[model samples]
Target: MFKKIKYGKIEVRSQTLVLFSAIYFAFILNLAFWRYILGHVQINNFANFFFIISTAISVVSAFYIFFNLIIVPFAAKPLLSLLLLFSSIVNYMMFSLNVFVDKDMMRNVFETTTAEAWDLVTIPGVIWVLVLGILPAVFLIRIKIKYLSFKKELFSRIKLIAIAIILLLIQVPFFYKSYASFVRNHSEIGHLLNTSNYIDGTIKEIKTRLNSNHKFIRLDENPSLVLNDDGAKTVFILMIGETARDANFSLGGYKRNTNPFLRKEDVIYFKDVKSCGTSTAYSVPCMFSNLTRSGFSQSKARYMENVLDLIKRAGYDVIWQENDEGCKHVCDRVTIENMLERKNSPYCRTGYCLDEVFLEGLDKKLMNIKKDTVIIMHTMGSHGPAYYKRYPDRFKIFKPTCDTSDIQNCSRESVINTYDNTIVYTDYIISSVINTLKKFPNLESGLLYVSDHGESLGEKNLYLHGMPYAIAPEEQKTVPMILWMSDNMKALDYINYSCLKSKAKDNDYSHDVIFHSLLSILEVKTISYNPDLDIFRSCRTRRFPY
Candidate 1:
């Protein structure tokens, strides 16, 4: 029985408080973890039932041990309250969105802007936290703790820790095969473990930051531009799209006409393309670096020379027009024009801007081109759970759209419709860029649009992306890549457009192709340029015209 303090606060012994807190966390805070285990592991026999019981006991023991080690006499209630509140939010994210929190996902969380964070907030989320997290936390904070003498408390804690460890270890021998098989097959199960997942992710991210080398390795210091003798200025636009998946695109044979504008344009839509990573924080830098997806490291990539650096060294004026999040340090050395800062009346809103913000003064800039230039326009296309906010009113072609951020509450039809509308708007943005490129016929203008990564909209109960790459669904991996070339650009590189189109249809490509393909398209001669990875290399009639 609990003793009543002066302010009606329940006074309990430290050991009792720790035990109750651990039980609360194990049973209440770990719904997703228990759900995953139950769904994946069958309990057809008594042995299976015993395994489940053992697993539950082991989890509770683990929590008990963890709390005993971390919770001190003075900070016990405050610490438990905070953990409960945070665990609730994490649980909501995992249960509602079906996203796995890993190191890269933590990096995404750290790098997320205020506006981006607000997009994930919803009424249901608040209510869930209030009921399951805040109320419990308030109750925990109001509890008073009665501790024993220091020596006795220490002895008691040590004994309890020992007991918990024995409880955790005793089950392993009996269910060794079950444990081994479950762990081997369901590696992603670790991500479902609530407090452990985010805590592990945060620690790994911090360690990466501490261990990463600050000095950048220069790939090519003296790369040269090998322009055609015709003396026409080459204006290549690299448009980095966000979250636009091929499955929703009409160009890739989706039943929905999500690409009405792109269908009319003579662009080569590469149907089968995979992203470097499932998150923007990983994929954007990985695609720009000379390193292939297998070889890429974000830590190394931040300090290393990217394609933009080589292009700048090769004597072309390079500008990064960012409308999405930060360029992930890919455009660090280049001239960056944050389009979101422009606040153009037609395109700009409270904190974010439309993709059309990139097109505002594009024509004038192209017309006044004084030299060969590469303009990298990063667009915020189809980023959700606020899919309806991505596009304008006119581009809401898909009917009965999901307008709220609580997309879990929305019907499947409405969610898909809302997501499809964003793609349609993206189609308009890309085609508009192509049209802008067409107006500047004197310049050898061309455009390459590739999404950083794809998205998930309630597919297999998964919502937004950031699933670990190894276990990610095809919805989060298969992105759309489109290329548009002017007649002048075709002549400049001696590229057979028909041949490229033919290859685009049947051939598969990934983000690894971007670095080398950009070099090929820009006529940049460097040792880092791998002709083998270049998608346009086979279509070119001649090599670099140096």
Candidate 2:
């Protein structure tokens, strides 16, 4: 039996019922945080349980006090219930995926293609939402909460607020070291807190996108390139790869021959190359901009006219062919084509296309090319969690591969086999592009393949990518970079093929090199070019040699 309290104009509900209800909701909702803290922190004795319990109580009491203010005045019980349900759903998905709800994840939600989004839907995810979110929400809406008068409600809120403050204070001494360490080492833990996570992500995304959308200052003026007197036409192809890790490629000394085709194509593979960021959204724009990893920011990258623009300004014809998402505004000022939109292409499947699809009209596209030209191809190489869908069935050489979108549900070996098959397919695509380049014998040509970023494949219990760059694992930062030049292009004394080959195996490179390397190779002269960041700078022993 619950005791009812008297109030000014309204009948007071059972005080015991209200108190227990708040406690129950708080305890259940904060379960994930408690588990995370318990697993991470060492337990010396029963005092550890006290700290953990106090932490959960503090969170719950805080929520209770805040909800009391709104629920009494605005009849916001349904609103609070809805918020809890929404947060529960978000938390459930994150728990199932072993992911944190952060700004980058929010960006992915916003920018993902239809096919990619469909890949995220699974029976397990649905069950998680139903068990954690919908079930609780249904019970919450069904609960009967009696209203007290304004005066009595206000008094009750004050009492609860006092209790919450006291409970929070109790945590100070017991959890000081743990709290400080967690805040220092795992600062992003704040982004995992329910409701706050999505709120923070939304705010940051809005502010960052607004800043990026503003007009940017131009980097170069009157940029130009003077060709050698030999009058050889230059054709530079930049292959922008996606979600490709160096560790998985045979060319990078991996045990598997994932890059069998590229390995035999006489390509110069650059080992130890790191990315500017850990996501395509960050890395694509950063790699094209005249900014080093230290100087990079999404806002700045969005505003600046990148290496391609400067190359175009220097009188070289530039075009971008994309099978992946749009170029992150990198090709805004250049000629650009998307393969997915092209009709009658057998390579297009379920609203997405493979990397090779972009090469269909290549010969016709290059028939009237300029003396100096640069073609950039952006690939959808090995994008997950549907790695099996990235390539054709014929390329599924690795048997027992994970064919489902739920990569985590599959065995580790199957997931890896699926991923490796995608790599092998990518190798084939790159080799095909090389063979296409060989068709035009009259022009001096070169191809440089650089991934936007690397991927995580069940390493440290992490899968996929979009991790923060500073704390990202080596798999997410180290990417494959391969280069190839036609015999005619390699013959130039100043081009220095030997020098490039000599350092290709040992030199350390990053996305920072991309901007300047393109400029240097294209013979573009500009004030913004930094020779130090150019990978070819050491190789160019005779810049003036004709």
Candidate 3:
């Protein structure tokens, strides 16, 4: 069979292949890990240098032992090749994009759409994978492994494992204190461990999904609307933003005029608001749940009733207009208008539609509003590495933008320019929604615009979001939240706009306030409503008209 093949093959012992693969992963495939280690660990003397060398040896030995145990004669080549390919891609993302592949990021990967996934596929990334991942994997597939007798192979594996363990253990005793201190301070180091990081993350995500019971747990049983004395219908729009950080908003003191349109509106901009999670997979569902950021669980929230459910139960016409990805399953029970599926809309292209697509039939929808309603417009705001694609060319107010998805290749100024342009576009969308709402004076109208999470635009070498919340920089957590209420809505709800504006400026807020705030805004009286978390509680002069 080997002689018949036209392509040449390299014959090697199973043990030899495992050792080489382990060394390759530990050294060549772990550039980000080694870079992080070197940058964080200071070498003051010969002893420190020796400790670094010992750490490398220990990592290499550990990989060798793991590979030796897992790689059988029949499965060695395929398994190792797959690992090499995946590790190379992971390494490129970590080293170039500065993204950490933890459980939440893995969840993002699984939940990401094909179009969103393609946005990440850049020329540089393809080249990196071809050179480092594909070439090695192909070479590995062509290699034939020679196995010894069963008893001999078993003894050989045991001997190698013992030697690797000894090498790893010897360093621990000499540098135990150094290791402890390094781990204690830099807990994020584990997220850089090339293959293990993503693999462990994937496993943990899978386990969480499997363990979830998927039962719908209703929160409020007899929730009812606190009807106002005035017979006017209320229309509230909750605009959920994507990848929009407060740092770029002019309303939030950003140098650029990203919120050019929003600044002109009567919107109250909350500058110091944080998100429940750093990624959409976690934050979107979390913000609507009664659970606060610290107490949120994705599995539990998935099956439980959220704010939308409660509001719908309270007799409001709830509709979710999705322009981004599928609402992270939060709109599963609600009436969803998937704007991306709309036929031949001018704002839509092949893969995705711009935020303006939400305005297409919105006027007609607003005109037909008869009852109190809550509409969620989930906008594709500043979602990148294709920030340039999020907005139209006319909205490209910031010039010399980073046009390509390979954002790392662009200058930092170009990246920010491109990102700010998206914010500018978002400002247009939000203002358009508010303007549309303003036209309908008969209906008590208002809008709440809050980002699901923020983005990292080359801050601290971090290109995008999804860093663990514990160590995530403010760039990924701090988001802009804008609230707009028409005069009629304010009068009907007895909400003091001045008081709310004061609260927006002085108080610290997070995604935790969203559920209660929505309940308070709509006057949905239920046992699940917590007055303490409501930002509008103090501002509302009158009590609920139950």
Q: Per-model C-alpha lDDT, please?
A: 0.89, 0.78, 0.90
Candidate 3 lDDT at 129 equals: 91
Q: Model 2, 1-546: lDDT tens per residue? A: 333345423232534445654665565554555556767766777767666666677667776665655565335556766766777667765565556667877776777778777777777777776776777667645555565676886787788778877878877667888667767987766755666677688788888887676777799987888564557778889998889999999988999889878877888999989999888888999999887889988778778889998999998888898788778889999998878887679898777887779678878765666668899999999998889889998999988999887888999999999999999998998888888888887777889999989888999878888877767899999999999888887765366777788798868889999998888878788889887888877787666211
Q: Measured by TM-score, how close is model 2 to the native structure? A: 0.90
Largest TM-score belongs to which candidate? Answer: 1
Ranking under lDDT, best-scoring first?
A: 3, 1, 2
**What is the lDDT, from 0 to 100, of the residue 442 in candidate 2?**
76
Which residue runs does candidate 1 get wrong by more than 4 Å? none
Q: For candidate 3, lDDT tens digit of each residue in 1-546?
A: 123224566667778777888899998999999999999878988877887998899889989998988789767767888888899999999999988889998999999999899999998899999999999888777777777899999999999999999988877789988888888998999999999999999999999999998888999888988865578888999999999999999999998788889888999998689999999999999999998988899988988899999999899889999888778878988899989898699999988999999898888988888888899999999999999999999988888899999999999999999999999999999999999988888889999999988999987788899998999999899999999999998998889999989989999999999999999999999899888898888888886533
Clashing pairs in model 1? none
TM of each candidate vs. truth: 0.98, 0.90, 0.97
Top candidate when judged by lDDT against the true structure = 3
Clashes of each: 0, 0, 0
lDDT of 1 by residue, 1-546 (tens): 479988887988788888887888887888888888999888899888988898888888989999898778767777778888889999988888877778898999999999899988899999888988999888777777788898998999999999998877777778988888898998998888889888999999999999999886999878987854567899999999899898998889899788889899999999789999999999999999988999998998988999999999998999999888889999999999988788655899987998888889988899899989999988899888899999999987878999999999999899999999999889999999999889878889899999998988888888889888888999899999999999999987899999999999989999999999999899989999998899988898986534
Worst 10 residues of 3 by lDDT: 1-10
Off by over 4 Å in 2: 1-35, 69-78, 81-86, 138-145, 211-215, 228-230, 544-546
lDDT of 2 at 385: 82
**RMSD (Cα, Å) of model 1:** 1.2
